[model samples]
Structure formats: structure tokens, C-alpha cells
Target: MSQTRSADRNETGPDRGVLPQRLAGLGAALMVLMPLAMWLANRSAPLTLGLAAALLLAAAAAAGSSREVAARLRRLLATPPGLALAAFLGWALLSILWSHDKAASLRAWGELALPIVFALALAASGRFRPRPTWLRALAFAILLACLLVMVELASGLSQRAALGLGKLMSFVFNRPAITALVLAAPTIHGLWSLPEGRRFDRILAIALALAVAACALRSESASARLGVAVCALCWGLAALWPRLTLTAAGCAFVVAMAMAPVLGIAARDGLPSLILNRFAVMTGQARIDIWLSFGEVARARPLAGAGFGTSATMHRNPVVAEVAPEHRLLLGAGHPHDMPLQAWAETGAVGAGLLVLAGLLLLARLRRLPAREMAPRLALFAAAFAISVVGHGAWQGWWIAVLGAGILWFGPGAARPQGEDHG
Candidate 1:
């Protein structure tokens, strides 16, 4: 009777810990809803919603109903990488706080804070299980967000003339590359998590692919499109290439594709000309010029950087000066389009080094995990994160931190034999 009851619980129960499970669902749901809500609220809702959700999760976590859940959280906190990542971010935040530009530093700090806290919360919740149902819920939320954006665009309800929803348009309006990076991680996760046998899963995956394509077409953001392609390629290679050589080759192909613009190669005939003509006026070679300028500045200030958010202060070109009168406002003109460049420009070599080191450590840790167990999901996550870094700028720190937290949460402690949970 006890064995039968255990089987039933494994198949269907409250996921062993109610608070943690609910919080996971809530986190996923919020990720989808917040974008649409931000659009409707004209970008103000996200801050409010984020703060409220954080508070609510904190409250729930403090209730202390489940000793098992609490114990798991304690164990996660004791992990070396988890503790180190948190400490490094905390130190970075402190440095920002002590900087001269308190407001800009505060804003940057806030961006990092949200993801870090969410990651910790998710990790602490002790419901680190990556079940099919949870993945479907997350995917459905993203699809719904995409649909809402399409509706807003089609109905002429958006304030901007862009093809995406009004809320995301705000971010995409300023930094489409970053937005693409943020969206890519979750989309890849959803795609990889989908069950192969389910017709609905296949349909959903196809729909998501089409949605990403349409968003890219409508926005005319090359970086966004590249991000999606890179993510897809990464997932494909990781899922199919159980061997190291094939995976390496696949990775090389993805790297080449991502760097095509820098290599002076066009994705399609006439594409380069079209992009140059469309975005040249706004971004000046669609950020190639800005990236070069940032490199020079970083070379000048190799230690502490020009200081966080100091790119505009160092942008001496007459055209950029006229376009961006203030330093912080320079992001509006076209800040560094590359993540490493942005980090180097703002925080200097030290900051950039720390960031790179963190990434390397993450990759190494993920690689050490049991391939048969977490290889597929870990590969998907790594690929998505890598694409974001290579394709965009500093806008992905939050998502990167979140992905790290999720991996840590569901990693060693949550590992179960492949078919153990199968009923």
C-alpha cells in the first residue's frame, strides 16, 4: 500500500512542496506577463510588478511550513559556486553604489538585483524539479506574450510603429539586442524541455520558431534574428551531438554565423545594404562604429574603466556628441553593442575580467555534470547564454544571473536517475 501510494504521489501530487512549486510557476508566469503589462502601463508596470512579486515570494518563503523544503534551501546555500557567484555580484553591487554616479549605478544595480534575487528565490524554494508540465506552462506564457504583442501591433494600439508589443517595444526600441538575448534563453529552454512524443509539443515548438522569425522580420533587428538562430543551432547541436567532435564543429558553425557581420559577410544577398541603409543613421553602421569607439576608450582606461555608465562621457565624436548630449543618455544613441565591450567601457578591464571569469566558471561547472542526466537542458542553457553574450551587450547580466541560479537550483541536489520518476 505504501509503495502504491508513493507511485501515485510521484505521478501526481503538489510537487512535494507547495510553496516552492507555486513560486516557480509564479516566476515563469510573471516573466511572460510582465512584458505585456509593461507595454500597457507604458514601461512603469515592470518595476512595480517586480518589486511586488519579490516581496510576495519573500513572504511565502518565510512562512516555514515545510522542513524538507527548508533543509534543501540550506543545502543549496552551502554549495561553493552558488555562494561564490552571490558574493561576487554583491561586491560588484557595492562598487557601483560607491561610484560617483549614484543614480546610474543604482539603476544598473536594480537590473542585476532583480535576476539575482529571483534566482536565489527559485533556488531556495526547493522545488527545483524541471517537470514537463512546468516547462509547458512557461512556454504557454511566452506564446501568450507573443500573441498579445502581435495583437497590439495589428490593432494599432501600440504607441510605436514597431511590430512587437508596445511594452517590449520600449526595451527593443532602445536595445533590441538585449531584448533578443532575454527572450532567447526562455524560448530555448522551452523548446528543449518539450516532450518529443507529444504532438502538441511539436506544434508549440513550431509556433515558437515562427513567432521568433516574425518578431525578427517585423522589428528588422538583425541582432535579435541572429540571437534566435544561434539559440536554435545550440539546442540542435547539444541535443543531437552526443559526441565531442561533432559538438565542437557545430559550435564553430554557430560562432561563424554570429560573427558574420564583423566578417563582412551577408546572411542573404542585399541584406547588408538594406540594414546599412535602414539603421545607419540611428546606430551608425548598426553599432560597429560604437563598438570600435568603445574599444579605444577601454584601451585608454584599462583599470577602473571610464566608470560605470561613463561611455557617453568618453564619446568625443562630433556626431555622437550632437546625438547624445549626456553620458547616460548615450545608451539611447548606441552604447557598445558587444557585452565585453560594454563591460570594459563602463567598469574597465577589472570588471570585464570578473565577468568573463564568471562565465568560464559556469561553463566548466555545467560541463562536469552527468551528461546522461542534465546534458540536454544544460546544453540548451549554455548555448542560449553564449549566443546572448556574443550577439548583444550588457543587457543580459540579469538573465545570465537568473540562468545560473536555475542551473544551480536544479543541479546536483535535484538529480534523479533518468527513468526513476516514470510511473
Candidate 2:
């Protein structure tokens, strides 16, 4: 009877191992599918929620019933950095509820929730430890999507600008620039992880770079371009001055902001009529006016914001009269084109503080880990996230949640350990 019981245990245990593998596979497939869903839905809430649910289930399943899963989750929650981030997010949500435009605030807050939840879920599952094959699969998906977009854009050229796809192709076919930024980080990390001097590796790197460049160039969206540029600059700074990178980045940001108006105007009215036409009266070009108006609204109701999705009210405010007539049609503006400002305007200072704290906590958590273990990937993710914001404004909740989950699941670095080297 003892032997029979032991035999039974062996069979069942093997089956259990299969479950984790199956779960991991599902998680990976969902990772690819989520972006596709976003493309199809054009970043709508229903699609985002569906993807988020799928990711959570996949992560949970991958974790199985292992004692290690529970232990790791406890450790993660107990970590001061993680808790601080959660607290900040909670504050932000509370602030959102206090907004005058409660419905709008709720809508805006809903967008932020997705990424946070996704990240937490991934971290909790402990199944995101890097796997080369998984990384390769992700890279392939991104490349395929990019290629399809390129083909579509090229095909439309002969049909003239009338049939030209441009942003539509990006939004519907490939990941939007914001999503691209997130996806790009992992692709770069995967590239770096590959054995050096391989022809295929070089080819892959070039292909990814080209795809990224193409997406940026064709986007016609200013913030998206800015996001990619920022990401590149971050990579350079991180390589040169890991310690002073943040300070330098801050300085650079100030300088950029100071110069934006001058350069922006030139871009808006430049001789290259096509480019200028794209920039003129664009959503990004009007961000300054919108941001300024948003500040005033927030000031008027400091404790609670205008409420989520209340940017429309601010847009229709008398302030709209001050903007260029061409830009006056922005009454339906959904956000202030800045994350912190949007938070404050929708939720209040308390909510904004929480969002800020959460971001800082994420950065801090990344800092505590060995650079060699996580820096490359973190750098990529940071670059992508930053770039996306420049072009697309702040990400919605679902994107953030899924991205966070991906990082947590995969953050510890590749399963194969390597010696620490700061450089």
C-alpha cells in the first residue's frame, strides 16, 4: 500500500509540473495577445479589462500551489518600497473620487488602475522569471506586427495621401507608440541577452531599431516622438553616468521644456508643408494651453478635482476662447496631456501625491536590485514608458497594470545567474 501511494504521488507530481509550464505558456501568449487586443480596440476599456483578466489568471495558474509562491508574495507585500507605492496609488484614487467631475475622474482613474494591477499580479505570481524562448517569442511578435504596419503603410502610398494609413496603421496594426515603447524595452533586453558576434543577433537588433525608427517617424504624433527620443537619451545617460543620470535627466527636461515653444512653433509652420501640416493645430501643440487651464481648475478646487474625465469642462471653460481658433474644438479633451496634472485635476493633490509616490517606489525597487541583473531591462522599460508619455500622454490603467505585472514576473533577471558588474 505504501509503494502504491508513492507511485501515485510521483504520477500526480509530474502532472502538477506540467500545469506550471502550461500556465507559463498561457501567460506568454496573453502577453502578445494583450497588445493585439489594444490595437483592435484602439485602447478602449472593455478590451483592456479582458486582457487584464486573462493575464491575472495566467499568472496565478503559473504560480500553481507551490509554498514558494505564497512565500514570495508575502515577501513582496512586506517590502517597504512596494507598500509605499501601493499607498500612493490608493491616495491618488481617493483624490479622484473627490473631483467635481466625479464621472470624469473615475474614468481617468480607471485608466491608471490597469497597469498597476497588472504589475502587482505579475510580481505576486513569481512566474515571470526570464526565459529565453519566451523573450524570443515576444520579440518575434513585435517584429511581425511592425512588419505588417510597414507593409500597410507602403501599400497605401500609391493610393496617395487619401488612402495613407499613418497613425491609423500604428493604432490598429502595430502597438501604438506608447505600447511600442513598453514592448521595445524587452526587445532590446532580449537583444542584449543574446550571445555577441552572432550574425542573426546583429540582424535582429538592426531590424528592431528600424522598426522603432519607422514607428516614430510615421507616428505624426509629437509626444510619441518625444518619448522615443527620451528613451534613447536615458539609455545613453545610464551607460555614461548611472549615479548622476537622474539629475542630468532632470536638467535636460527643463532645457527641453524651455526650448519646446520655440522649436514647436517652427515645426508647426516650417517649410516642409507636409510635416508642418501634421504639427499645426495638433493635439500636442495645444497641450500647453490645456495644461495651463487645467492648473487653474485644480487651483479652484484644490482638495477635490474637477472629477475624472472633467477635462472637457475645463476645455469648454472661457479659457478655450484664449486658445487659437483652430485649437478651440478641443472641448472633448479627455486629459491634460500630463500624468501628474491629470491626476491633480481629476483627483486632487492627495491623489497626485499617491501617483508620484508609486512611481518613485517603482524606481527605488529597481535601484535596490543588482544593476547587472535588472538595469538593461529597467532602462528599456523606463525609456519606453517615458517616450510613450511624451507622445500619447499618460497611459491608461490596464496598460500600466499589465506592464507592471510583466516587470514583476520578469524583473529578477534571467534564470541563469551571472556575476555582478556595474559596467
Candidate 3:
């Protein structure tokens, strides 16, 4: 009977190992798939990832880790940073009540809400240690994604044309390029964090970093290029004096959110011809013009904003006539091309304040991490923040999802050790 019981235990042991290892594999695959999805799925990638995350959570529960996961998630949600993010989301939803277009507001709210929810869900579910295999997979994804972008640029988007994806492929690579940039930041530290990393992982890490920088340089996305620049600056500063960078970053974010509309005023004076014409960058002049116009919209309704999701259509608002003709002419560009500016234009002071508070709280929380970990996260945040300030609309679903994906890549708990009893 003792031998019978021993045999039974051995049989069950392999069964237990299978579930956890597979779960870890799934988590890693999701990370890789998320970046690749940026190319094919476009704006819908966020929703795709959110769905995947939900499925992951469901599977985790069914694997007999439900109670432990739930308890951990509860503690996280109850923390100051978690509560702050919830409050910010609540305020954003409330702002939709005042949106000029209710239907659009609701749709936009779903885009923002879904990603935030799933990102938190994943964080509460597992622990992602930087294993050699995971690092290689992460690096390979970056290389593959960047190479595709390079190929498209070289071939004049022949693949997109072949697919009947339309003729206007000028900025087609923007989404994927930016996605690669975000992933690359975390990948940098991830590769570095791999203990006892093999020669392949080391070579892959170097190659991956070079590929990301090259993609950012070669891709048409101005934001991706700027991300590389911003990331380097932030990464260096954070590595040297993490606390200083975090404090400055937190303060800068608050100020930007608090004063989004008028930032252009400080930025737009006597510099159009000097910077816009001479710089020869694609979006330089256009960005300044957009900033000037959207600043008026935000200035028009500072306290309450035009309402959530209004920046995309703020030009149609009667307020355009009130701003200067030069500034007003560019309002049709669909967005401020700036994140903090978008927040101020849509959610007004109330929403912006909550966002600022959440940012500060999050930065404050990072203080608890050792400098090694905190530096990389700070670099990621700073880079993303820079992109938001200069490039993407703050609330765009894909961009937000990409940011969520960045956290999964950089933050703890995106994966777990194998051979665990629970998934």
C-alpha cells in the first residue's frame, strides 16, 4: 500500500507541474504577442490584450490559485497607489457626463477603462522573474518587429498595399514602432537582470537594443525617435540619481496636467520660423500650431473642459473662432498631439488634478523599490511621459494599452517560476 501511495504521489506531481509551467509560458507568450499585435491589430490591439488578460486571469483561477491571487489583488487594490488610480478613472468617467458628444465619450471611456483594468489584473496574478529564455524571447520579438518596420519602410509599405490596407501608408509604422520602443525600455533592464545569462542571451540583448534604436531612427514615427532620445536621458539620470529623477518627473507631470493649455504659449513664441523651418522635422511646425490652437480650447473651459473625448473634435466647437486665425487654422488636426494638453482640453482641472495626484502617488510608491529596479521604471515612465507630451493623444486606446504592456514588461509579476503548484 505504501508503494501504491508513493506511485500515486509521483503521478500527481507531474500533473501539478504541468499547469504552472504552462501558465508561465502563456504569460510570456502574451508579452511577445502584445507587441506583434500592434502591427496587425492597430487601435484594436488594446482590446485584444485586455481580452487575453481576462482569459489569463480566468485560467489562473481555475488552476487552483484563485484564493491566493484574489487575496493579493485585494491588498494591492487597497493600497494608496491603487486607490489613486481608481479615483482618477472615476473622475475620467464622470467627465464624460459633460462631454459635448455623449456617444463618443462612452466609447472612449471603454477604450481607457478596459486596458487599465486588465493591466491591474495581470499584476495581481503572477511574478515575472527575468529568466534567460524569457529574455531571449523578449529580445527576439523586438528584433522581429523592428525588422518588419524597416522592411516596410524600405519597400514603401508593399505588404500593406498588397493587403489592401489602403494607399495612405505614410505613418503606417507609427503604432508598431512606438510599441517596440516601449517594450525596448523594459527589455533593456530585463536582459540586464538575467542572472547566469548565456552567450545567446547577451548577444540577443545587445542586438535587440541596437535594433530598437535603429527602428526608432529609421521609422517615420517622430514619436518613436523622440522616445529613444527621451529614454536615454531619463535612463541615464535615473541610473545616477533615481530619487531626484522621480521627484522631478512627478513634479513635471503635475505641472503639465495642471497647465496644459498654456504650455504652447510658452513654447510658441518667436520660434516657428527658427525651429519649425530650420529643424526640418516632419511634425515640428505642425505640432506648435496644433498646440497653439488646442491651448485655446483648454483655456476656453479651464475648469470643466470641453468634456471627455472632445479633443478629437474640439475644432468643431464654436470656440475656435475666438483664438487667433493662425492658431485656429490648425485645429482640424483631430488632436492636440499632446497628452497633458488633451487632458486639460477634455477633463479640465478636475480630471487633470486627479491624474496628477495619481502620478505623484505612483512616483511616491516607487520610492520603496531599490534603486536598481526603480531606475528602469522611472526611465520607462519618463519616456512614456515624454511621448505623451509631444506626440500621442493621451487617451488613445492603443497608446494606453501599450503603456500597460510596458508595465507588464518592466514591472514585477508579469510571469512566474516554473514547477509551482498553483498557476
Candidate 4:
């Protein structure tokens, strides 16, 4: 009945043509299938292929949209999030002039362009909004994937080695960073299901949430654990005081910032050494060492970065060698694992600030939504943010694809309430 009503809602309009609608559906379907993509092919292969299909389909839909194509483009670019995205993308492209390796920088631009185009296509697919069922679907998909991860992990300790049989992998079964990136989707979706689902559905959602959280904790990602902790705190605050939602968020952010230093010190001092030691072998510290190295390199060319994708070349510099020669030699030259540092290193302070501004605009957009709608989006954002804070190359293809998927899945259209079916 709910499904029928949703169909009716779309059909009542001037048909929008079957092709465009199907294309939109196809794009959404691909996004929902991302985890499974990771499981089948390489971690990013499915995502890249799926999203590529999605992008092509969405563009076709947009071109076929009854609304004028130019008008849609203007509308998308006019929004705050859109403008911020444009600023960052434009800045990144312009940096090619100053980029140490123009070819690599141009390649980086191509990778960056994928998400930007995907986002625009999604924006243009106006009626293709995220719904409660879509949320349920995404959550269920992630839940199943987490179960698979657990199964892989259960094979045995030797198999559980980082490169072993059942080691902690990202959604793509790649290397581990933080558990939050993969689990955030399901966890947040599960949380959103609690209030609106039937008894069995609620039970299933709760079980999935608990299971995913446990899996994250058991994994080798400190970031995942930290991100989950933040999500839980936010979930608790919202659950306990539904009326003061924004207040709860403000409190959470302020507290998180204040506690970060303290937590860092504690972690370094062996507060959770037994647990921390498990991840030490994963080059968790080595990644941090790389980030520190990036910081030194970023300092030299603070205004315009060494160039997009230039970190590999700059890592051999004396500045980084002087700071942590042993760790530097051990880790080799790689992109900075942290986004802010990556932006600063490649695009400079201006790029970093624009990236942050875009994020803030996205959050502000979420803030405008009704609480029921906002909750999961906020949770997903928190999870993604926490995971990215300490891991992944800023422009890594898979990372960009995953982040882009999240952005479109929970973005503006997704956040809008669609009457009682959604509420």
C-alpha cells in the first residue's frame, strides 16, 4: 500500500517520461548496490562501474527532463552546496598551473570530476528523492555486508591477518581504516527505521544496529570505534530529548572538539593499548606518520599546494625526512590519509577552507529538515566525517566514489519529507 502510494505520487505528474524515471531509478539502484559491488569485484571496481552507469543514466534522464536543461543546471549551481562544490572544483582545476606534475594533476581533476558530475546529475533528477523504503533498502544492504565481513572474520586468526583471509576491509574489502565508513550507512539507516517501522522491522533494525556497531568495535579501526561512539552519543541525545535536536548536536560537536586532545593523549599513553595494539600492525601509526609528513610539506607551499597528486614526489623532501626520517622511509611516499591535510598539501589553505565550507553548507541543509528526516543524514555525516578525519587519500578514486554516493544518497532531495509515508 505504501509502495502504491509512492508510485501514485510520481505518476500523477505529467509522466516525466518513462526513460528519465527509469534512469533515476537505475542511478538510485546502483548506489544502493555499492556494498555488493565491493564484495564482487575489487573494492572500487563495482562502485566505479555502477556509479558510471548511474551517472550516464541520470544524465540521460536530465536531458530528457521536461524542465529545460540549462534551467536545471543553473538551479543546481545556484544552491549553497553547489556553489561551494564549484568553488572547490574550480580551485582544484586552476591549481594545475602550479601543480608539480600537470599530468597527474589533470588525472586528479578527472577523478574529482566524476563525483561532481554524478552530483549534478542527481540534482537534475528532481523527482527521484530518497524515501523511507530507500533508507530501509540501504540499511538492509549494509547490514548484510557487515554480516559477510563478520563471516570472513570468523574463518580464523591467520585468515584474519590484515592481508589475510578475513581481515577488516572497507566496504570494498580493501584495507581497513575506520569501521565507521562502511557501517555508518547501515547504522544510521537502522536508527531511522526505529520510529516508523512495524514491530518486526523495528526489532530487525535494532539488531542490525547493534550488530554493525559490534562489528565495527571488533574491527581493527580505531576511527570506526570513535565514529560509532559519536553516532551513539548523538543517537542517545536525540532519542532522549527529541525536542532539543539542534541543541544536542551543538553540544556534541563542542564536546568532541574539547575531548579530542585528551583522547589522543590517552590513546598514546596506552589507555586502550590492548585494543590499540591490534591495529598497530595495520600501519595505523605509520599512516599518522605520513599525515605528519604531509603537514611539513604543506607548510612549505601553504598557499598553492605542491600540486594535486604531487605528494608522492614531495615526500622525499628533506623537510619530511627531517621530521620523521625513520617512519618516512618505512611508509614510503603516499597521499596524506587525512582530507584537510591532503587539501592543504595539494590545493593549499584556500582549497582546504572551501572544502570545509561545502561541508558546513551540507550540514546546514540537513539542519533545515524535519528531525525524523534529519537524524540518519546527520548520523551518516558524522560517521563519514569521523572516518575521513584520520584515513584515506583525499582524492583516492574509491574514497571519492563512496563519499559521492553518500552525498547524493542523503543529500537535499533525500532529506526532504514526502508526506506521511516518509514521516
Candidate 5:
């Protein structure tokens, strides 16, 4: 049940017209080459964003009839997930009025909004087609990327030097490693679910999973390791009881938003000085101080927040200056480096509550799906959720784009003709 049952019964299918064929080819290329693209990103969000844009446009071209697009969008927006996401986005827009940097808030809101339109359309559109070979190519791509990343890490990043990508640190491969972790879930599930006699595909899936686990354990990125652990756990849990896992994850989001500030304050006060210092060193930031500062800010303005998109410039705002000197280490820190904490800080109770509802609705929409579909998606949610809470900014464009790219396979084309693989 952990496997996603590929519609292998009919590997053969009716012919696709020329335009559809072209779209399938492009989609296949994007799916197969995604891992390499992430590696090439070298931790640059802009490069990742470009890759995500290409995917959205390709999907649009595939399912882009005006009538079809309108129908799909209308249907999606009618669902709880779509409606909740819309409400959250609206709340974000409203926060702009109170934002210290209104222009920046508007820009950030776009980064969050644009990707959803493309993704939701694809998910709701029946015209989009997926290929079996694309899934095969995906596993191979992840395998190839893992081998290459290992080579880079082992050789002191010699390949990076030859590419003229600059003298970036080894942490550059961190994102690629994390990408493989997220991609591995569906890739392995699809491969392992091959028909009864297909031993080769199952073997490949097992090998890919091990390679992904190896990369996560080998990397210096703690977040990547956390993602891998959560992926495995959720993959198993969702297979057995998907509804329970989804409900728990949704409830966790709400509880986390409510208690984030309190936990930060408690940790700062109760944790031993030595333990706090170790945490600071391990995270490579003054994490405790940042947490306390942002925690205090959230506590001070628990309702509407200091306003969206202000986390980056919060140090300059008068509200942050009024906090105690010890909590003032947020200067030029860029972001609080924690997603839920940032949401709690910038959007306050209103934004956080909307986000919690959106998260639950999005996940609940997956209910009653066949076990094959539910497992992979829930596993992916686990990895993404882990990445969100463990690290990264709340509104980073590339992060939003990567999330969009990951869901390309989720829409209504499951029984699509497999002939696209041959076309």
C-alpha cells in the first residue's frame, strides 16, 4: 500500500494529437531533468524560480484551452482547499495596508499567489496527461543527481569550480540533496508499484530510496535529515491510516502557530546555557536570540502582527526596538529562519489562523483517494511540512516555486493514456 499503483494494466493507449504530444514531451523533460536543475541551482532561489516558471508554462500549454482552464479553476476554487488558500491569500493582501513596507508586501503576495493558479489548474484539469516513462526517467534523474552530489561533496566541490558558478560554499548542494529527498517519495512509490512481474522497477525504487537516505545522512544540512526521517515515517503511516495522518498534521499546524512564541520563550529561559549555545552553534546562527526577539514581537502584537513581509526589515521598525536589549539581536538577520515563527510574527493570529485552516483543507481534500495516491502525497506533505517548520523563510519565492513543481503530478490525469511515454 505504500506504493503508488501505476496504471500499468494499459501501458498502451490511444494516439495523442501533435500538440498534445509536444506538451507531453516537454513535461517529460521537465520531470526527468528536475533533479539536475536543482543541483545546478547552487542554492540560488532565482534559478529555482525560473525552473518552476517553465514548469507552470508547460502545464498551461498542455491544458490551456480557455474554456477548459476556466472550468478547472472554477471547480478547484469551489473545494475547501482552494477556498481556504484563497482566504489566506486575501488575508495576506489585507495585511499590506498595515505593512511598514506596503510595496514589498504586495510583491511578496504575488510570489505566493501566482504559483497556486498554475498548480490548481493542472490539478483540476482533465486534459493534462502523464507518462510512465516520465516516472522512470524521474527515478533515474534522482539517482544521477545523488551520485553527482556525492562526487561534489567528496571531491571538495571540484565540479563546482569547473562550472564557474563562483566560490560558493559546500552548503550549495544542500538544496539539491533536499530536493532528492522530496522527489524520492513519489519516485519510489511509482516504481515499486509496478505490476506483479516487473521486478526491475521495484529494485530500482529500493536503490533510489537508499541513495536518497544516504545523501540526507551524509549532508551537513540538518533540515534535509529531518525531511528524510519524516518522509519515511509518513510514507508508512499514510499507507496504513492516511486520514489519521492528515488530521494530525493539520492539527499540528494550528497548535504550532499558537504555541510557537511560548515555546521560544520557554526554551530561552529553561534550557541550560550550554545546551542553548550548542543549539546556536549547530544552526550556524544566533538562533536563541533571534527566536526570543521574534518571539517577543509576536507576543507584543498577537493579532494582526507587525504586518506581512516586515520580517526582513523588522529591525528598523520601532516595534522591534522597544523589546529588551537581549532580544534585539535580530539586526540584519534577514529572516527568522523558521517558517511557522515567521508566519506567526508577520501575520499574527489572523494570518496564522487562516494558514492553519488552509493547511487542513488542502490535506483533507486528499481524503478517500486510493491508497496508492494518498501515500505518495501524504509522504510529500510530510517532507514539505518538515522543511517549512525546521527552516526557510515564510515567503521565499523559490520555496513557493519548488512546492509548485512538486505537485505537478497530483491532478486528475491518473488514468491518462500511457502512449505519451512512446510519443
Candidate 6:
């Protein structure tokens, strides 16, 4: 009977460890190549690669331990971050009922949900933790991509002007903002991980961080510069008081929302001339104008909104038309360039609120981690925040892929052995 029971136990055990391991290995390979995927293919390619990896991760988890995967999924759904994301996605889907462009809204919803699903897979798959080797590979890939950009800049890859900035791009479709954003997170991670690394790693980290900063400056992407600055501030705050970091971040968020409209108006009223000149002034004014217009759209439909992806169609708001007539055509076709405004304008107050809730929960999670982990996470968060405040279209496929990849690549690596070097 003992032998019979033992045989039964062996028979009923989860999967053969080999299968899950292979799946996981395959997933890791895809994740490591995500940077190159983004550079060589369309924006969707990176996300496609990430989604494939995530699905494989899920498969690996299920194969390794079905019951464990189920339980983890349940636990994730109950968590604040999960709940918030679920709510936001649900609200977005429901908005399609009233959306004028059903097809477009559905596409937007799918795009928004894809990243969430990918993130969920990462968080739930306990065995699929980010390996340091994979992280290093991604960093090297980014460095190579940056080198290509530098070459392009030197050789004049294109005669087509870059948003009036004359900044160069890789011969490929890469942009300064996207490149800088990608580099910012890992560079911050390198600095944060320096104390715990070997002497060689310390030198490498310093060199990488410096190179990333130089790349950002040379790229001359205002958004990337802002992201870098915000990351620096976050790192400083993390070093000072870990507990207070969340409070200050929350405060800053609130202050920014409160001041967005006012600042936009001020910029239109000649404040830019007093503070900045030339390109800076023009870009600042453009952001301000778009932000104010989005505010108008949100105010027009405080409850249900005009509907997801309907920002383009709903730009006839009298306030936006009057306040920024020159922007009317652009407003009819472009995003507001601000995440909160994008949510509020397209998905209504409920969607925006859920987004805020997700952010707060993320901050809460960060608060529980050590300084070394906290610093890099905070840096990445800062970069995402800054970029969102002045970004491309809300539902831009490539932009979504970039943001998702950044989070996936940098987020899970925060975990370390108990005695590892910390910030």
C-alpha cells in the first residue's frame, strides 16, 4: 500500500519539470530581444513579442503547477493594482456602448488590456522571475541601439527635419523620446544597484549611466530630459525618507493636476516668453494648449465621456475651439498628450479615478521594498510619469509597447537576495 501511494503521488504530480523549464527559457529569450524587436520592427512587434513571452510564462506556470497558478491569479485579482486595472478596463469596455466609433473604441480597449494581461502574467508566474542575465542582455541591446542613433546623428541619417529640432534618429523608426525613455530606467537601475555589485559591475554601471545621460542630452528630447530629471528627484527622495516618498509623490500628482489647466492658460498668455525661448517655448505652448483642450473635453462629459477613442471626434467643444483655434485641426486627429486628461476625456471620471487608484497602489507596493529596489522602481515610475505628461497619442501602439516593455524589464528585477548590495 505504501508503494501504491507513492506511485500515485508521482503520477499525480504537476508537470514534468522539463516542459515548464523549456517554456520559461523560451519566454526569457523573447523578452531579452524586445529592445531589438522595437528597433527593427514596428511598435506592435515589441508588444507582440512581450505578449508572446507573457503567454508562454502563463503556460509555464500552469504546466509547472496548475493549482498554484490559479491561486496566484485569484490573489492578484484581489490586490489593489489588479482591482484598479480591472475596473479601468471594465469601464473602458462599457464606454463602447455609447462610443460613436465602436471599432476604434474596441481597438483601443484591446490595446489597453494587452499590456495589463502581460503584466499580470509576469506578476503571477512565481517561477518566471526576471533573471539578472536577461536584464544585462537588455541593457546591452539598448546600448547598441543608442550607438546606432549616435552614428545616425553623425552621418545625417535623414534630411527630413525632426519636429523642427534637427535632432537625428536612427535610420530606422526609432525616436529620441522612446530611446531616451528606454535607457533611463536601466541607467537608474545600474546606479541603484551599484553598491551591491562587484567592482567590475560598479564601473560598468557608472559608465552605462553616464552614457545614457549623454544620449538623452544629445537626443534633445524635452520629454526625455523631463523624465531624467524626475528620476533624479525620485532617487534623491528615496535616499532621504522612504516613507515620505509616497506622500510627496501623491502631493506632486495632485498639484500637477490642479495646475495643468492654469499653467496652460498662463503659457498661452506669454509665460513661455518669460521662461523659455525658441523650440522650448513652442513645445511648451503646444502641450499647454492640448492639455487645456482635453480639460474641456472631460468637463463636457464628466460622467460617461464622449467615449473611448472619441477624443478625435469630440474636439468641437466650444472652449477648445475658442481658446486654441490654431489647434482645432490637430485636436480633431491627435491625442491630448497627457494620460490623465486622455483618460478623463475619453473614459470619463471613473476611468481616471481607477488610474489614480492603480498609481497609489503601485506607490504603496514601492514603499514596502528596500531602498535599492525602491530607487530604480521610483526612477522608472518617474520617467513614465514625465513622459505621460507630454507624450504622443494615448492609444499609440508603439508607445504602449515601449511603456509596457520598460515596466516589465525593470520592475521585477527589484527583488534580490537578502544580503545583496542595496541603494
What are the lDDT figures for the candidates, one per model? 0.48, 0.52, 0.73, 0.59, 0.69, 0.62
Which ranking of candidates, highest lDDT first? 3, 5, 6, 4, 2, 1
The 10-residue segment of model 2 with minimum total lDDT is: 414-423
Q: Across residues 304-413, which tens digit of lDDT does each residue of candidate 3 receive? A: 87778877777676667777777776777788888888888887787777777777777776776777778777778878888888886677788888888787776453
- Best-performing candidate as measured by lDDT: 3
TM-score of each: 0.66, 0.72, 0.87, 0.75, 0.85, 0.81
| lDDT measured at residue 390 in model 2 versus the true structure, 0 to 100 | 44
Worst 10 residues of 6 by lDDT: 414-423
**Model 4, 34-75: lDDT tens per residue?**
665554443453245346556544555454544543466677
Candidate 2, TM-score vs. the true structure?
0.72
Candidate 6 clash total?
1
lDDT of 2 by residue, 177-198 (tens): 4455566666666666566445
After superposition, candidate 2 runs with Cα above 4 Å error: 1-17, 35-37, 44-67, 101-104, 157-175, 195-199, 250-278, 283-285, 312-332, 368-378, 381-385, 388-395, 405-410, 413-423
Candidate 2 vs 4: which has more TM-score: 4
Q: Per-residue lDDT for 409 in model 5?
A: 46
Q: Which stretches of candidate 5 lie above 4 Å from their native place?
A: 1-16, 43-64, 124-127, 241-244, 269-285, 411-423
Give the per-residue lDDT of model 1 (tens digit) for 1-423.
699557544532244356644564565455444434433443333353354346435434544434544554565555554565555465556556435566766676566566655555544544344455545554455455555545555655454556443443323422322233344344444455555646777676677667655655555355555555655565566555544623463454445323422321222232566666765343435455454455555555567655554443344332233232332234444456565566665666566556555544444454454554345444444545444444444544434453443343243333233433211
After TM-score superposition, the amount by which residue 215's alpha carbon in candidate 1 deviates from its true location, in angstroms, is 2.5
Root mean square deviation (Cα) for candidate 4: 5.5
Q: What would the per-residue lDDT of candidate 5 be over residues 171-247, giving only the tens digit for each residue? A: 87778888887767766776777565368888888899999988877777778888888888888888888778877
Which residue pairs in candidate 3 collide?
127-413, 127-415, 128-415
Model 3 vs. true fold: TM:
0.87
